[model samples]
Target: MADTEHSSKNVTEVSTDQQSNQSSKVEFSEEEEMLITMVYNLVGERWSLIAGRIPGRTAEEIEKYWNSRHSTSE
Candidate 1:
């Protein structure tokens, strides 16, 4: 039972690490950067409106992309 629990914990840790690495791989291009900046400028704090203006982009998607780019650079 102890061995099973340890193995499960190890597996979970490895999976989490893999997910973190995958997330770190995400990034934005220069065009994406400009778009995000433009959106913020146009809408201020209204992220939904800004996201709507960009075809197929959601607020969460933009945030995730930016975060991933930052993480990779760091």
Candidate 2:
């Protein structure tokens, strides 16, 4: 019983780590970046509006991406 419990715990931990890794490695194509910048220029930081124009991207993700991109440039 203890061995089974330990094995299950390890499996859960590994899966959780994999999920985090996947989520942290989001990549945006150059076209997506250009669209994001264009929309941002038109609407300012209205992330949801920008996201609406870019399929598969959430407002939070766009905001995070914008912040990271700008931060590194500055």
Candidate 3:
């Protein structure tokens, strides 16, 4: 009975950890994509200012996404 209870507690903790990781993933809406593209075209990779225009997105995420997409090409 103690082992079973400990197993259940570990499962709960693991589930919470998974949820926390999932929450950290940044999802972009269509409007956000449009805004990112428009701003990218105009300002040319100013991630901080671009992120400022986007709600719920940090400049680091913006930079990471852009780099993931464009770094190979450049």
Query: Which candidate gets the maximum lDDT versus the true structure?
Result: 2
Q: Tell me the spans in candidate 2 whose CA falls farther than 4 Å from its real position.
A: 72-74
Ranking by TM-score: 2, 1, 3
Give the deviation of candidate 2 from the true structure as CA RMSD: 2.5
Of the two candidates 2 and 3, the one with more favorable lDDT, higher being better, is 2
Best by the TM-score measure: 2
TM-score of 3: 0.57
Give one digit per residue, the lDDT tens place, for model 2 in 1-74: 99999999999999999998888678999999999999999999999999999999999889988987887652
Model 3 lDDT per residue over 1-74, tens place? 99999999999999999997775576777888789889999998899999999978988888766776578752
Q: For every candidate structure, what is the RMSD over all alpha carbons to the true structure, in angstroms?
A: 4.2, 2.5, 4.3
Candidate 2: worst 10 consecutive residues by lDDT? Answer: 65-74
The lDDT ranking, best first, is: 2, 3, 1
Positional deviation of 14 in candidate 3, in angstroms? 12
Q: Native-vs-model 2 lDDT?
A: 0.93
**TM match of model 1 to true structure:** 0.60
- Candidates in order, TM-scores: namely 0.60, 0.72, 0.57
